[model samples]
Every structure is written in structure tokens, then in C-alpha cells.
Target: MSATVSPIREPLIEGGKSYHDITVDLVRSTEKAPTRLWWIAFLISVHVLLFGVFCILWTIWHGIGTWDLNRTIGWGWDITNFVWWIGIGHAGTLISAILLLFRQKWRTGVNRAAEAMTIFAVMCAGLFPVIHMGRVWMAFFIFPYPNTRGSLWPNFNSPLLWDVFAISTYLTVSLLFWYSGLVPDFATIRDRATGLRKRIYNFLSFGWTGSAKHWQRFEALSLVLAGLATPLVLSVHTIVSFDFATSVIPGWHTTIFPPYFVAGAVFSGFAMVLTLMLITRKVLKLEQYITIGHIESMNKIILVTGTIVGVAYLTELFISWYSGYIYEQFAFFNRALGPYYWSYFGMMFCNVVSPQLFWSRKIRRSLWWTFLMSIFINIGMWFERFVIIATTLARDYLPSSWSYYVPTWVEIGIFIGTLGLFFTLYLLFTRVAPVVAVAEVKAILKSAGDQYLAPNTEHHEEIMKQYKDAEDKGKVYGSDHAHSESH
Candidate 1:
């Protein structure tokens, strides 16, 4: 069969064949070590997950009184964790939904895992609010359904209600968005399956045939979903901030909370992305696919968002002082110098000062340094939430109401248990799903960059010389041309 050349430039393999035409057996090709690493992760996460289950059961059997919450120090690790996990969720949506709208190609390497991270982190976050209600079973009271006992509705005016709406919306939208991206990938696996796996993959694939027509619609739908998710991302964090903004509490009530919280969320989210991508890129041996350039791009975002967060901190302090509200002033002061001052200082050092190092190319490119920075950013973000919730609640308006809150064993166990939940979901996702988008990879592999195509230049030069010799022999045409010119 004669080869038909494509009008568009096609990616050439070492032998000048199209890379897109090469079929990969992912099961055979994927590294054994990565699989082993995932198995180890699975085993560890399961143990921790079981431990979390025990903590939940113990908390349920005992009661809310088993924990350290009081009237004064009502919110503690629960709220802190909720905010932290939710913030982690933001990075995925930002990378996939927001960056996609901007047509950023580098996002392809990170978006899949980030989206998975978003879903899992949100799951971890949703657990806190439910469990923190003391009577875990009675947590449904936050719902807006009509009650038989009285005509009571959840307070629409409350930030807690806003959080309920925001988080539920965010989770629902994120799941849909993530699932939509998975459909084509699931089809790829389905085609490679057999027996029981075939049936399961068929169910998941929903009859995807990789038709060009279907792909066109799929692309359009993905764009629409990305657009929807982008706003939802911003709104979710803004509403989370409103949980603090609407409160009459001094440090918590600030106009700057929305942008500040969003910035902080993106900052923490990118850090988590870096943490996961660094490991995955190395473990999966996807160096050519992910590339150092992708890591550098994320590092730039981390630096930008981290600086924005830093500015927000300074702004919060400035506003707190400028408002002439003594309570606000005191709240800011207490954050820096109060009993929990060390946590606040830790937050500043980790979030504000630590990420500045990423501004340098050397630090951003080093995997070890990026890993350390990611961990530091996570710790700092958690501390930030703690400072916001714990410090604010610890010292309210009245001295009589002032009290210290310490996490009981149950509280700490539940907190540690949720980490298990996050990891469990993440590990499973990496194993079962295409951790990277197969179609997008195929598409990237199809695009030939701006390099001139060269094929056997030595042979071509010889052919050109032969053509020149043949042309020189056509001097009869030159003689005819001279005769016509003389006439």
C-alpha cells in the first residue's frame, strides 16, 4: 500500500513513522516498581483507614463529651482540617478547569491526579463537619428539609449554611467534571479487557467507541464542564471565607477574607499537586511525558499564589489595625503574640517565607527541595486554619468566656484517620484509572513541533546531484532558446 502523507505535520518516531500509530500495552509497559509502591501505599492506607474507623466508632459509642470541644472553644481540629482539605481540593479544580480554559498544555500532566486529589480531599473535608457535629447521626439537621417537630429551617443567613451549600455544590460539580474526563480513558481500558473485567469496563465506558463524532461532542462537553467548574472553584472558597467573614468575631470578620482565602487555597492546592506529581513522575518513569518544564510551570504558580497569600496576610493585619475596631486589633495581636502565637508564627514562616525560595529556579527544579517545600506548605496551611478558627474562638469578647481547647484522643485519632481516607482513595485511583489522560497523550504525540523534517539527507543530496546532471544534459533546450532569441 502506498503511504499517504498528511498535510499537517505529524510527530515522527526515530524511523520517521508516526508515534500515534504505535499501540501501547499499558499493563505490560507500566513499571513493576510503581505497582509495588502503590501496593505498599494501599496496605498502609488500609491500616490507617481501619484505625480511623475505630476512632469513628469509639467517638459514636462514647459521645461528643468524649472530645475536647466546649461552649467557648467549640471549633478546633475539625474545622481546621475541613478548611485545609477543602483548600487542597481547590488546586485540582484550578489546574484542570481554570488552566484548561486558558488553554495551558502543561496542565495535561498534572490535571488528572489533581482532579482525583480534589475529589479525595473534598471527601476528607466533608467528614470533618459531619463528625464534628458531636452526634454524628444528627448531622442531618443542617439540611434544609422541613421538620415535623417545628417549622424550623436551617438558617439561610449563617455562614455554616453557606458552607453546607458551597461544599455540597463543589463536591457534586467536581465529581461530574472528573468523571467526564475519565470516560474516554475508561474506554481505552475496556478495549483491553477480558471476561469479568470486560463487563465492568463496559459498564464504566458507557459504550464509548472513540468515534470522531463522539470525540467532537466530548471535547465540547469538557469545555463546558471546565467553564462551570472554574466558577464553582472560586465560589466554593469564597463561601468558605464567608464562613469567617460573616462572623462577628474579630479576626474572622474581614472583607479581605474572600480573596485571601482563595489565594491561600490555590497556594496549598499547587503545593499538594507538586507533592503528588514529583512522586508520580519519578515512580511511574514518565520523565519524557511530564518533563522538567511541567514541574517548573507549577513552581511558578506556587510562587505567584504564595506571594499573593503573603500579601493577603499583610493586608489583613493592616485592615485589622485600620478599622479602628479594638476587637479586630486584639484578634490580630493575639494571632501574633497570644498563647497560640507559636502556631501563627509557624504559619508565617512556612506559608509566607518558605515559598519565596521557589522564586529561584534551582530550588524549583530540585525534586527533594520541592517535596520539602510541599510538606512545609501543607503544615503552614493547616496552622493557618488553626490560627483562624482556634485562636479566634479561644479568646472571645468576655474574659469569663476565655478558655483553652486541647484535642482529646478521639479528636486526634479522627484527624489522623482522615489522612488514611485521603490516601486510600488516591492510591486506588492511581491503580484502576489512567492516572494520565491517554487521548491527550496521543494528541500531544501527534503534534510535530517547529523543526524541519529531515529524512536521509545524504541520499537526498545524491538524488539532487543526479537531477542536476540530467538538467545539464538538457542543453538542447538552451540552444533552442538562443535560436528563438536571435530570431
Candidate 2:
């Protein structure tokens, strides 16, 4: 194609050519075959899932009695699992909604997988409360709906009831937020699909045509949802913390629980994001899309949140001592040097001290180190919950009632099973859902400009042409030395 050599209105490149004459090819390239590693991950996750089923069957036959639950410590691994999974869901909204509001470009790389993590984590979380209910069928009694035989109503003031509301709201809103972004990408698949795939994509696309008007409305709706979700994410965890803080137990009754829990939620959530992104970027061959910048940004958040959580831990101990409450003081002492002291220290070392290493750029950028760190962070976060719930409840008021709680085989089974369930769903989502937001990526690649665009790039030439014409007219006719400034 013929090209202009000079235009006073456009900024000149090193060669003194105006507008840089950038060109971009719009046609996307696809991989020839699914990566071998993805198949390996899928198979491994399935094997773990089968082990989970065996555990569930054993639990069903053995009954709740198989798990240790004394009067003083009614909640144990089940509650910890619930909180851990819910906390894991937190980062998805933060990455998607909070970062989106800030217009952070790096989010495009991680948001899809993070949102998928939120949905799967929530699914894993929902199981604990249901399975813990024993009958499981009567789990709906937590709902506020009226019963025919009795004038029964769930206590709105209770945090558990609030959980029903908060969890439901978070899951509903996150699903909508995720699907809203997926629509245009789904349309891309719809256009590319054949046979039965076409019908499935067609229904999911909702007649999307990728018109500018559709994008305009879609962007507006996304922003609105993000606004709604930002507070919703914070509130969900705050309410969850209240489930502990509102209690009369000495360790659980602290005022700092809300913010502490929020920090931990975000900390664990970001860890989960890191875990998934590290694997996905390689599995999907998306290293160019999900650059090192994105991982570093996530690591920074993890580091900050880790420090906050560490501070919360120290502050709680300080307040417990300063308050001069014997029970509160004992709770802190027990957590640090009690029977489960190893667990407490493990949580501290993993959640608090370890993330400090992420401050080093080399640690953040190293794939093997990042992967190990993410796993440690998750383990640390899980132990944080376990220590909080188990340690606190295991040694409450009245020495007569104080008894150490232990998780039986069934309890262990269910806990392990949840991990299986989480990865199983995540593995399936990788295959079925768009692993990355293709449409959003295209928009980003377009805006980021010629740095990523390559030769035979005909589609963007029209854009360059219009841009040049607009720039040319805006300049005043002048000598070769003349330059036009952008308003």
C-alpha cells in the first residue's frame, strides 16, 4: 500500500515518519493441539476427585459422630474449610471489580481465571455448611421462608443467617459479573464453532453481534456491576468475620476481627489467583498475554495484605494483654504456646513471614518460586483459619468444658474432598469456559499499539489512515520543522 512520508500534525518516529504508520492483523491464531501438561493436570484432578468420593461415602456410612465435636468445640475443620473457601473467593472480585475501576491493564491477564476461581471456591465453600448439617436435605431451614407446621423463622440478627444472605449475594453478583464479560467472547466462539457446539454457543451469546453499541452498553453494565461488587466483596467477608467476632468466646470476641479477616480474605484470594495464573499462563501458552508485570502486581498485593494480617496477629495479642482480661490473655497464650502451637507457628511462618520475601522482585518473577510461594500462602491462610477456630473453641471458658478438639477421619476426608472438588471444577472450567477474555485481550492489544502488532497487519491500517487524516488537518500549514501538539 502507498503511504505518506510526512505529516506535521502527527508525531515523528526515529525515521522521521509521522504517525509511525502502525498496522495490526486482526485474525487470531489457534493452537494446533491441547498441551500435554493440561491433560496431565486434568487426569490428576480427576484421580483426586475420585478419592474425594470415597471419603464422602465413608463419611456417609460413619455418621457425624465419626468426627470429633465436643460441646465446647462444636465447630472445627468444617467451619475452617468454609471460611477458607469463602476467603479464597475474595481476590477474584478484587482483581476483576476493584482493579477494573482503577483501569489497571494488567488485570486482563488474570481476571478470567480469578473469576472462575471465585465461582469454584464458592461451590466448595457451600458444601461444608450443607454436609455439616448432617441431614443435608434440611439445609434450607437456614432460609427465612415460613414453615407450615411451625411459626419458625431464621434469626436475621445471627451471623450465620447473614452468611446465607452474604454468600448468596456474592455468588449471584460474581456470576453475573463474570458472564457479562464472557458474552462477547462467547460470541467469538459461536462464530467459530460448528455442529452441536454452534447451538450451545448460539444460546449463550444472546444474539451478540459485536456491534459498537453492544460494547458500549456492555462496558457500562460491567462498570456498574464492579461498583456494586466492590462493596459486596468487603461486606461478605466482614459479615463472615462477625460469625466469629460476635461470639462470646475470648479469642473470637475481638473488635479487630472484621478488618483482620478482610485482610486475610484478600491475602488468601490473591494467593489463589497467583496459583491459578501461574499454571494457566503456561498451560494455555499465554505467557505473552499474561506477562511478568501482572504476576509482580499480584505479588505486591499479596505482600501488603500479608503484612496487614501479620500486624493484625500482633495487635490481637497486644490488645488481649492490654485489656487485662484473663480469658482473652489465655486465648492468646494458648494460640502461641498451646497444644496446637505448631499449627499456630506454621500459620505465622507461612502467612506472615514468608510473603515478605515477595518484596524481592526476583522472588515475584521466578516461576518455580512463585508457585511454591503461592502454595505456602494458601497453606498458611488455611492454617490461619484452623488456628483461629480450633484453638479458640478448644479452650473456652470453664475448665470443666475445656477439651482439646481433634478432627476424626471423616472430618479429614471431607476437608481433603473439598480440595478435590475445587480442582475438579477448575479443571473442567479450563476446557469449557474461555480461559482468557479474548475480546478484552484484543481491545488491550489494540490500545497498547504497534509494540505487539506484526506484519500483514491490514485490519488496523484503516484505523491508522483515519487517525492520520484527523491529525493532518489539525496542523497548521508550516515549514518542515513545524509540529502539532495533541489537545
Best by TM-score: 1
- Across residues 420-471, which tens digit of lDDT does each residue of candidate 1 receive? 9988988777767767766665554434211222333444567777766766
List pairs with backbone clashes in candidate 1: none
Q: Using Cα atoms with residue i matched to residue i, what is each candidate's TM-score against the true structure? A: 0.86, 0.85
Would you list the C-alpha lDDT of every candidate in the order shown? 0.81, 0.80
lDDT of 1: 0.81
* lDDT for each residue of candidate 2 in 1-487, tens digit (9 for 90 to 100): 2332222211111121122111111112221244577678767877777776786676566666667797888889988999999999999999899999998766876788899899889988988877877776678888878798496888888998898899999999999999989877777767777888778988988889989888899999999999999999999999999998998889999899999999999999998888888887776656656667678888999999999999999999999999999999999999999989999999999999999999899998888888899999999999999999998887877888888987887778777777878888887777666676776665555333233233324445766777678667774344223553332
The TM-score of predicted model 1 comes to: 0.86
What lDDT score is found at residue 341 in candidate 1? 92
Please report the candidate that would top lDDT against the real structure: 1
